[model samples]
Target: MAERVWEPGDRLPSRAQIGQEYGVGENVVRRAQELLISQGVLEGRAGSGTYVAEPRERVRVVRSSARQRVRVVRSSAREQPSGSPFRADMNAVGRRGVWESRTAAKVPAPAEIAARLGITEGELCVRTTYEFLADGKPVQLSASWEPYDLIAGSLVVLPEGGPHAWAGVVNRMAAIGVTVSHAVEQPEPRMATAEEASLLGIQKAALVTHIRRTYYSDQGRPVETADIVVPAAHCEIVYEIPINR
Candidate 1:
């Protein structure tokens, strides 16, 4: 029947008819039909006989799941995507980058946040949230936390306030004689959470790139930590690793 004696969508012979044609019992023919259906060579519809399936619409699906991972990486930039929605590479020829930030002083850190910052749970920390804009439209969100003990009386503690306002962590820490030695990053891809979706104005469950980072002082003390999120479909990441001889 598959040798072109029948047309596309043609119905195959019944189990009994096929059994007689091949000199086999109906049960044997039934098994072959079942296999064909599973392979998409044939399709069965309720209240109708099986027919040749539309193979052009063939699809193969495979899935696997494992525990989520958190990797310690060398680089950590809140705006890592060189070509993100708010970054320069993604802007149309002449658009400029813009951002709005809100900082909360002495916010109690959550347990998980405390652990990352190497402080006891509920310790006070400075928390800052930012929305990156491209032509006045938001495209990314980031939140950062720094333990109060690290910058208690420093003018740069407020993140976006004081003399060194709007300066990055590396520079701000320098104002207090704290040299930021390095940073560690853990990046992952996942669906947007409800709060993230609402703030980014994207649909729930939309795929996003979430990166968590921790900055350390030269003395190995965690100085800052941050969570940066961007729409996955709109961002592309490029990594540049230096090889030492």
Candidate 2:
């Protein structure tokens, strides 16, 4: 049953019914059911019949469509013209999204960040760390860095502050005459670090999807880079790439 007949959420047949079908005694059927449950294939509910357990695996959806759909949806969100992409994504799935952020300026750019932004190590930068919640539960974390030299004096430097609050990388950079021409993202699935696990409220070394995203200017300069961490159990990272036919 575990190998072929039953699915992730299907309830097992009654012991007697299974015994009759398989020509086995009830005790034999009961032992088999217990073994399957212990092996993580089935679960028992109090006062309710046993059920199949939900698989603890990631669900991946790769989109081979136009990326323009994202921008279109962002513009058409009637009430909040500047609503957060995070909130929009959650609302689409009937969930509420909120994020808390702490921003620090004048920090030295870390080594990996410097490479992504094409800057020297120890260069002054602004870092904003965000914890995104869905229905009041932490589900994602984003740590973003931008070279201080680029928008030092502008209000956009304060990511969650000023008039452009919750404004995305594209709009915020545009305020300083740096039109974001494109963004590149690389997603990898790996075990979460101790810090990430604590922040995301999951177990240490739990499965997670790590995303490295960089925004670029029309002149092809890297303006900002971010490390986005999402809990595998709660998030589904989707990509909508244009199919070159």
Candidate 1, 166: how far from true, in Å? Answer: 1.9
Range of the 10 consecutive residues with the lowest summed lDDT in candidate 2? 61-70
lDDT of 1 by residue, 1-245 (tens): 33335556998778898777768999988777766654446667667887886644211111111101111213365323121223332233355556789989889999989999999998999999998765565567899999998899878778777666545677678779998777777889877888987786554566677878788999999999989887654444443344559
Full-model lDDT for every candidate: 0.68, 0.76
- What lDDT does candidate 1 reach at residue 97? 59
**CA lDDT of 144 in candidate 1?**
93
TM-score of 1: 0.61
Regions of candidate 1 where Cα sits further than 4 Å from its true position: 1-95
Query: Which pairs of residues collide in model 1?
Result: none
Residue 48 miss distance in model 2 (angstroms): 23
lDDT of 1 at 154: 74
